[model samples]
Target: MKITVMTADEQFITLDVDPEESVENVKALLEVETRVSLQQQQLLFNGKEMRNAERLSSVGVRDNDLVMMVLHTSAPSSRAPTNDLSFHPDGSAINPGAFQQHVRRDSDMMAQLLQRDPALAQAILGSDLNGLQNLLRERHQQRLELRRQQEEEMALMYADPFDVESQKKIEAAIRQKGIDENWAAALEYNPEAFARVIMLYVDMEVNGVPLKAFVDSGAQSTIISKSCAERCGLLRLLDQRYKGIAHGVGQTEILGRIHVAPIKIGNIFYPCSFMVLDAPNMEFLFGLDMLRKHQCIIDLKENVLRVGGGEVSVPFLQEKDIPTHFLDESRYSKQGSLGPGSLPESSGAKEKNDNMPTGSRSSGTTLSDPTRGPEFEAKIAKLVDLGFGREAVIQALSLFNGNEEQAAGFLFGG
Candidate 1:
C-alpha cells in the first residue's frame, strides 16, 4: 500500500509499504530517503503519535493515508546549513538539490516523466548539478515569454480601431472580441448546458436483492431490464398481454409487465410495479408513474429522493461513485431503433454499399461534408455573415446536424 508521509517542513514523501508493517520500519525507510535519523523521527497520524512497535493497520492507518513526520536536532546550531531545502505549496523545490533528491525517491512521478520526456529524465539523473539548474532556468524564461506575448496581444485588442496604422490588428481584435461576447452571453443565459449532469439514483431492494434505481421523471412507466427481473425472481409475475413496442426519442421492445412487487426503500416496503424491457445494458429505471403513486419528492436543493411522502429519504449517488458503464449513452443508442418522428434519409443515400463505414448514421439533406453540395455552401455563407469564421460555422453546423439554433448556440459556447 502507498502512504504519504508529510514532514514538518511541508515536504511530502510517498512510501509504498505494507499495512501490517511495524511503525519503526517505516521510520527506518524514511531515514534512508530523508537523511534524518530514526531517533530524530516522530511519526503522527490523525493527530495521534504512533508507537514504534505497533503495526500501521492496528493504529488505523490505511492506504493513501497521511502520516506526519517531525524532525529533531540532537544539538542546537547557531546557523542553518546552506544545503537545507524546503518546498513550496505548488511542489517546486527551493533548490536543485532538493528537487533531484525528491525525484529519485518518487518512483511514480519519475515513471510518468520518463514516459513523457526522456530529455527531462536525463537531466535529473545527471551527476552534474549545472545541467539541472540550466533546465530550470530555461523553463522559467519560457513562462515569462508566454506571459509577455499575451500582454502585448491584450494591448492590441484595446487599441484604437479607427487609427490607420493599427487597422488590420484592430479588425482582427474586434472579431475575437465579438466571439468572446457571444460566448459570455450564452454561458450567462444557459449555465446548465456547460455543467456535468449528475443523474439522480436511489438505493432500493427488489424482493431481497439490492439494486440502484435511476430516477428519471421523464419516463412514462417504471421499467426494469429482463435480466434484473429474472435475478429478483419476479419473472413469474410478468403479464405478457401488456407487451409492446414503446416509441419516444428512441424505440425499445417491452417484454412484459410485472403486476406488483414489494420494493424496500430505506426502512419501509412499498408496492411497486415494473415494465420489463429486453435491454441488458440498463438495470432499472424509476419512472414518473411510480414516483407520482408513492408521492415521492425529488429535492434538488437537498439532493435527496424523498419516498412515501417525505417519510423516508435516500441520498443520490455522487459523480465519483456512479457506475462507469451507466454514463455511456452510445450503448443505449445502439440497442434502440429509429422512432416515428425521425427524419428521412438523404436523397444521395447509397443502397447496400459495402464500402460504407460501420456504425455511421445516414446523413440528411444538409450535407456534413461542405464539398458535397451548394446548399451547405449557402448555409455556411449565411452563418459567416454573423461575424463568425467560415471554418467554425461549417464545423458547428455539421456537429449539430444542420439545426440553425443549436449550431449557433454551440458556436456561442453552449
Candidate 2:
C-alpha cells in the first residue's frame, strides 16, 4: 500500500508499503515521523479501529492513499511512550520508511523460505518491536534489508499474493455459492477473511501447577471453565461484575475466570494480543485471533475445514445423523453462545411437555430409541466410529432434529 502519513502536525510522508503490513505498523510509522508515542495516537481506518493483521491491500489502501493519524494526550504516563521516537535507549534516529521497507522485503522473502520455518519471520517482525526499531536506526539500510531477505528467501521458493486478485477470488466464490445478491453486496466485505476459527495454546502456571490446554478451533476462546478455574486457583483474573457468559446456541449465565490466548491458525499469529472472555456456563467462542491467518474452505457436506492453500487438513469433523421421530424442530433453531434464547439441544433436552399426556411417567434420560432401523443404525455406526462418545453423538443428533444426514454431515464429515 502507498500510504501518505499526515503526522499530527499535518506533515505528509508518503511511502509505498507492503499490503500485508498491519495497521499497527502504520501507527508505528506515524510514531516514528511524529515523535509520538503509540499510546498517544488515534488511528481510524474508515472511522473504525485500524485493523490489526488486516493487510493494507485488502483494505483498499492504494499507493497514494492518505491515512489519518492523531495524537491523544491525557492518558496516564504509564501508557504513553516517553515523548520519543528513538527506541535505541542509547539515542538514535529511526528511519521509519527504511525500517518498513526492510520489513516488507523480509515478508516478501519469507515466501521462498522453507515451509517448516514460516513462523521465523513473524517471530522477528512481530516480536521485540522496540529492538527492531533500534536495529533499523543503527544498521545500514541496504545491508539490513539484504541480510534479512537472503535469510528469508533462502528458506523457501514461493509466495502467495495478498491483494485484490485474492479478494476477487473470494467474491467470485460468494457469487457462485448461490447466496442472495443483495445480502452479498450489502456486506462491505471484510478485508481478507473476516470469519475465523481461533487457534491457541494455554500457558498457566500458578502455585507450582501448570494446567495447559490446546485452544480448540471451533471453540470461541480459551475457556477456563468455571469449575476448572476454581480448582486451578486462577479465579483472580475475573472481576466479579458478573457480566454473564455465552455458550453454544443462546445460553447465558453469570460466570467468571477465563482468558484468551493469541495463536497462529490457518497460517500466522498476531501480536500485542488479548484474552478471551471468562464465563462459567459458556463452552467458549473462538474469534479473529484464529481466523485471520486462514483462507478457509468449509465443506458443509464433507464436514471439512481446509486452511492455507489446501496443503493440509486441521481435523475432520465427526458427523452424526439425526433421526426423524424424536426430532423437535424448535431445538435446532437455537443460536449463539449465551442464554436459553438458543441453548443447543443437549444434556438430555426435554421435548414439549404437553405432547406426552395429562399424566405420564417419563422414561428419563432418553433422546431416542435405538429400534429405528438399520439405516439409522448405520449412521450411528459412522458417528460411533468417528468417536463422538455415544452420549455426545446422541445429544447432538437430537438437537439437529434427527436430520441424520445433516447431523452426520455436521458431526462427522459426510
Name the best candidate (by TM-score): 1
Q: Which stretches of candidate 2 lie over 4 Å from their true place?
A: 1-219, 245-252, 257-394, 398-406, 409-414
TM-score for each candidate, following the candidate numbering:
0.42, 0.22
Point to the candidate with the largest lDDT: 1
> What TM-score does candidate 2 reach?
0.22
TM-score of 1: 0.42
- On the 0 to 100 scale, the lDDT of residue 221 in model 1 is 63
Error of 1 at 125 (Å): 17
lDDT of 2 by residue, 3-46 (tens): 77666776555555677776666665555444565567776556
